[model samples]
Every structure is written in structure tokens, then in C-alpha cells.
Target: MILLGYGFIQKIGSRDFFFKVIIYFALFSAVNHVYLVVNWAIDNPININRLRLYAGKGDVIELFGFIFIFCRKKLQINFRRKSYVKIAFVLLTISFLLYFSRTQAVAAIVIISSIYGYTKLNKKAIIVISSFVVLAGGFFWYLNKMEIPRSAEGLEGFLYKIKNAPKEMFSTDINVNNRAELWDKWRSYEAKLAIEQVLNDRSSTLVFGKGIGALVDLKDDFMLNGKLERKIPTIHNGYAFVFFKSGILGLSLYFFVVIILYLKAYSLKSANAISIATNNLLSGFGLYLMFTTLVVAGLYNTNSTVPLILGFILGVEHLNNLSVNEDSDNRN
Candidate 1:
């Protein structure tokens, strides 16, 4: 979609003040996080999908960085004119804030990468990148620490799928890809089964679900004494979790809104302010869609991050479309 919408991203990104798009999105997405975390900490239960957006600790802080960028733009600053090294230093400081928050390694990487791009010198960029080399190694080590033997089993299951190639392509038995293929299948299946249980057991009138940490229901009992059944929760899938919480009708409404928003943002092509601003959002969404099965996204309940990021991109694209359209009208 990003490629399809390249014209749009470039158009908005082209503007002197286009960086505001990033600023607005970062702040908005962060504030959204506050909403989610509060609900989870207080409410017995909440929709995992909804929480996925802003509940993340990093989600909040990262937005602050964007706010910083926005402030700079408002002041009419230029990287080429200012102290690029100092700018990189500030961003690096912000990254530590994220590292301590829910381990947002990827977001930090992207942010630092962005900082490098905005910097003035190749030599300085190389220095920044090299300094992070240690960081890259540390992140991998962290992943190793987080990935236990059981998680390794997840990896093996993925590998088996690749080697055996499920009787059907995405059906099952996806190997080595670990969470990508199998986790996706697992989450998707789990969500469906759990929902079926809900429908059969409960009436149409939706009420609060099994309650806090109900994710670990063992054959319908919280105490593990009942039976050694699998204790899974949150459906491990974004849309599914929402449906489980809000019901099918809720999901239908959401789908309608999302589809409308996506279409409106996607229609522009290198055209104007709106399209330019929204273009990057569309690209990220496209990238996520291509490689991400339900699993990669739903993991850690990171649903909101995708949409928040996508939404920002869309907003920028929309703004760019307007810019271009006006430019054309002015010429006309």
C-alpha cells in the first residue's frame, strides 16, 4: 500500500512543515495509551485489542519525542542549521525512556534511524549508527533472555511448518517462523473457539466477561485444580478480542469506520496535502498486512500501535492531498 501510495507520502513529506504530521501522531497515540492503561489497572477487565493501542509504556513516551519534534518545527528550526549531534543526543536520551518501558526495541530503532536521517553529516550519522551497534547486540541478548525453552519450542513449531509445509499453505505446521505462522494460527483458532464457548454458554445480552486475568480459565475454572487445560486469554488476535468484548455488532461498526477511513486516505495519489500526509500511514499498514499474520500483531496485545501509526500516516496523507489540491486550484 505504501508503494501504491508513494506519491501521497512524498507529497506531504515534501512540505517544509510536514514534520508536524509525525508530531501530531506521536502525541495522539501516546495520549491514547494513557486511556488504555488506566482502564486495565482499574477495571476488572477490558478489551485486550483496545488496550493493545496505548497500554504500552513505550507508547506514551515515544509520543513525547514526537511532541518535541513538533515543538522544534513550530519554532522554525532546521537540522541543517542546528546542532545535529545535540539533536541525536536528545533522541538517544528519549530512547532510554522507552527501553525501560515494556521493551520497545523496534520503535527505538526506528526513532534513532529517523534521527539519523534528519541529521546533516554522513560521518555523524555513521558515528550514531555505530554507537547503537552495541545497542543492537544488547537488544538481541534481551530477546534471547525473554525467549525461553518453551518459546524456543514455538520457534521449532514454526520451523516444522516450513519444512513440512502444512497440507494447506497457512492452515498449520508453519515452521521456524515461530510466532509468525503458528502463533497467528494459534491466536486465530483460540479466539474463535473461545467465542463459540461464549455464544453457547451465554445469552445474546453481553455482560462483562470472566473478569480479571480470566485469560487463564482452566476448563472454565480459575483454579488449576479443575483440570490441566490450556489457560489462554485475549484471543491473541486484535479484531477477535474486540468482538469478544463488544460482540459481533460492535466489530461490524468498527469495520465500517476503518474501511471508510482507509478508503478516504488511500484515494489520493501524490495529489495534495492530505494525500501526502496520509501516504506513509498507508505504507506502514501495507507493510504490516503483508508479513504480519494475526499473531505478530496481536502479540503482547499490540493492536493499537499499528492503527495509531497507520492513522497518523493517513492524517498526513489527507493533509497533503489538500495541499496539492489547493496548489492546483491556485494555478487554475
Candidate 2:
């Protein structure tokens, strides 16, 4: 991880190189999912669930970060061409909401609002406030009027099958509405059991943890029956996973990395749009990781895209520091 961070920092002086890479990668992923959806439509019309460009709901949000950055950086900023941003936002928002996943939809709303607020701070704030009230009111009214469906018999078994299955297991998209239901089970049982075992353990086990992948020892009946039956169950919560596997020292190190990156981003002096956008993306992603670690895996082992993007953002901050140091030396 240290080596990788160093490598990314080395590339910070290059403007828009990493940002363009990220945007192009997301575009490729989006296109790939479109093809997947088409294939699924032909093969299994009845079970056309939302298409994921990548695994996990959090990944969907990351994709939105790419899209948000792309639209902002790629589109022309003039009034005549500003329509492009609006058009892109509308189309991307609608398509992702309907076919991608709810998480992406929510991310789209957030990033769009944020970027817009950056451009038209005072006006955007008022508009966003009014829009929020209107949307909230309408949503509540719809919920009040809608009829609730009763759970059918044997549904639990079906859910169990999906929940324990390797690909579908713990996937929020597979059973979006039942997330709380699944989380309750993980929290009340599996996690609880693991915590108790730790508390009862002797030695300095709490300082070093049971070692990586040790949490898989908490498997139960649901996991046993699944095709992706595990030798060790994944702790859905990243923070807990780190603490359980690596102990307090590990968790502290993890936070130390985040705090250092945040400080770099906060202190960066770049005025370029791409640099500014990278900072915004980092800030958004940092918050996303904080919340997501409670429900899904963190950037550690899940995927490379997140760490890669974050690395480049940090690299930009490094570039800023370099410029600052150079200016001071020249003055001296």
C-alpha cells in the first residue's frame, strides 16, 4: 500500500491524466453494463434486475463520481453549451435510476447538486432547499397512499438461498428493500458472536487481531447452504472487519491514512478545474467510505478503482505541495 501510494504521488504533476483515465474507465464500464443488460434481456426477460457496472452499491456511487467529474470537466461551460451538462445530468440520472441501482441514483442527485452549488452557490442553495421540500412532501404522500405487500410463505427460504449464495450474498441490489432485514441478522447474530469471542479472548490478540480473513470462522446455516459456502464469512462492516482482523492498531493506522489524505486535499493550492474536481471527488468518496464501511467492504480489498482514483487525487495534492515548496525556495 505504501509503495502504491508513492507511485501515485509521483504522477501528481500530470494534469487531467488520471482524471481522464478514470472517466474513460467508467464510460467503458457503463458501456459494458449496457451490453450485459442487452444479453440478460435476451436470455432471461422475466428476471431483469438492475444492471451493475461493478459489484456492490458503493461501487455504483464511485461510478457516479466518475460520471459527475466527466460531465463537469468534459462539457463546455458557456451558456449556449451549458445545456450539455443539464442534458447529460438528466439522461444519466434517469437511466441509472431506472436500470442501474438506487445508490447510483442517489449519488447522481448528490454530485449534481454539489457541482451546481459550486457554480451557482447562492441560487443553487435556495433551489435545492425548495426542491428538497417538494420532493420529500411528494415522496411521503406517495408512501402514505401506496398499499403495503404482505410477505409470502417460503419467501424466507428463497431469500436465504440468495443471501448465502456467493455472488448474491450480502449484495444490496439483490434485495434492496430487505437490507435492514439482512443487516439486522448480521448485526444481531454473526457480528455479535465475533465481538463476544474477541472480548473473551486472552493474550494480546486484541492488539494484533486474529490475522486477515479470520472473521470467516463465523459461518452459519445460511452460509452453509449457499453455493458460495464459505470457510469464513465476510464481515460486511469494513471498520469492524479491520478491527476484528487487525485489532485497534490496524484501525488506527487506517484512520491515520484517511486523515493524512484529507489534510493534503484540504491544504492543496491548485486552482485548476480538474484539481478542484479531484478534491471534491476525494471529499465525497471519503464520506462515502465512512458510511459504506458500516454496511459494505472498504477500499482495502474490494476493488482497485477506488484506491487508484484516491491515489491520483493525493498525487495532485503532492503536486500542489511541490509547487509551494518550489515557490518558497525561489523566493528565498
Candidate 3:
């Protein structure tokens, strides 16, 4: 997908066009999400779990669209685009909050806050802040409308997930008697097993990994049914997935690529609003990818749009560099 995005951008020869494409797709996704929510609400008015079914992996990319539009509005003085920004912000925010994904919600708040910090505070800033307050109040009101009986329902469920995040990522203790705790710690358990297998294998395996198609053995077969299958093909941790398949070398190479792209995007200096917004979007996405890898498989997750977006950003940067070089030569 990365290569495809890069090639496509090269063919199009306009970063602005690509940005618009992303935004348009995001809007389409938001509308579909709203439809899903409304349709589900009409059918299952009392079921919170049914509402959660509408959340999809595409929500993250849609979020990137929101960030792109928001930053563009903040950096540029375009009164005509204000309405579009407000509409996109409201729709995307509703879709995002409906997803109930803690990682994504955290990423959005942190990235948006960071962007807000660097930009000047004005009427636009006040509008954004006020919008957030209104949306947050609405979110809580929606939660109140739901009949949440368990810890894993509505706002309570979201808080429970946040509370268990550390244990999910690092805890070694697994309580078989408590199904909730077991499910919460599943990622950590699988990751630990993968790491143990790598270390126990031949030293050579540590360098090149078990080499794709490798499986990690869960000694107890806790996740298995009556079939006695203890080995699994994949784990949730992106780092472990890479290390398990290709060893430390592959993992290092992956980080190297991510770091290079992030730095390139961050280093891009532009007075143009679109270029500046693109630079911020790319760099913010790099940070989001780095954080999400610990739990959501990050770039390795097939559901994620990270690779495609990263590729597009890389292509834009490549073109930007070429334009810079051409100008330098012409000046000389």
C-alpha cells in the first residue's frame, strides 16, 4: 500500500489533490458512520454493544482527515473554509467518540492538543475549545441514555479499558477464573510467550527471527478449544510480531524507516497552508503509529491505513525535495 500510494502521488504530481482526496473519503466515511449509528439506534435503542458494532478500523484514517482539516483552518486565514471545518469537526468527533477506542481517542486528544499549543489562540481557537466542551457534554448525555449494567458498557467500559491498559500491555499475571481479566491481559500474555520462544530458540534465530510463518506456543493452550491447538500465528504487539517473524534486524529496519520519514516530514518548512498542514499531519501520524504499535499492531495491522498514508506522505516529501533542489540549481 505504501508503494502504491507513493506511485499514485508521483503520477498525480499534486500533494494538494491527494490531501483533498483523503478529506473527501473521510467525509464519505463519516456520513456512512453516522448512517450506521442512526440505523443501529433505531433498531436497538437499548443496546450499547450494538452501537459499538459500528466502529471500524477506518475510523483512525478518518481522524487523520479531521486533523488535516483542523490544522489547515488554524494555519490559514480562510473564512470560506470555516463552515466546512466546523462540519467536519463535528461529524468526525461524533464518529470518533462512538467508536469507544481508548487508544485512538488518546491519540486524537494528544495530537490535536499539541497542534493547538503551537498555533496562536484566537476566535478559531475559542471555537474549537467550545465545540469540544459541547461534544463532551453530549457524549456524557448519550452515555446516560444507555442502560449500562456491566463494567464493560458505555462510559464505564471505556474507563475500565483505560484502567486496564497498563496491565494489558505489561502484566504477567493471568486470572483464568476471571474472564474479564484474562481477556484484558491477553495481549501481554501472547507477547510474553512470543518473546520467550525467541530467546529459547537457537541464537541465530534472535538475529533473523523465526522467519515468517513462525508460530508462538502457548504452553497452557488457554485460548484453544477442544482441538488442543496451542500455537498461534500472530500476536497483537507490532514489535513482537516483527521480532517473531524477522528477528531484531527486521525490527530495527522498521524503526529506521519510521524515524527517517518522521524527521523528513517534521523538517519540511513551508509558508503554504496546505504544505504546513501536510507536514504536521505526517509527523503527527508518525507519533500516533509509534504509540499504537504497542497494542494495536500499528503498521502491521491489516486494518490500519498507516502504510498507505505514510507512503503518500513520503511521496509528497520526495517531490518537495525535488522542487527545492530545482530552485537551488536555477538560482545558481
Candidate 1 lDDT, tens digit per residue, 198-254? 565566524443343445232432223255446665554445555555566655665
Cα deviation of 162, candidate 2, in Å:
18
lDDT of 3 by residue, 1-332 (tens): 99998998999997676667777788888888878878877876444455665545347668777666666554342435667768877887777677767777767774666454422245775777688779867865666566644456656666555556778899987875787777779899888889889999999989999988888887765645347667878788988888988899999997886565455444645534445555555656666777788888888887778788888877876676677677778989
Query: How much does candidate 2 score in TM-score?
Result: 0.64
TM-score versus the correct structure, for each prediction = 0.40, 0.64, 0.79
lDDT tens string, model 2, 247-301? 7888898877655543333544555554455555455555555544554555664
After superposition, the stretches of candidate 2 with alpha carbons farther than 4 Å from their true spots are: 5-13, 42-65, 68-95, 98-189, 224-230, 260-277, 324-332
The parts of candidate 1 lying over 4 Å away from their true place are 1-57, 60-82, 85-193, 198-236, 246-249, 252-266, 270-274, 286-315
Top TM-score model: 3
Clashes in candidate 3: how many?
1
Error of 1 at 243 (Å): 2.6
Q: Note the residue pairs that clash in candidate 2.
A: 216-232, 216-233
Number of backbone collisions per candidate: 35, 2, 1
**Better-scoring candidate (TM-score), 2 or 3:** 3
Candidate 3 lDDT (Cα, whole model)?
Answer: 0.71
lDDT of model 3, residue 286: 63
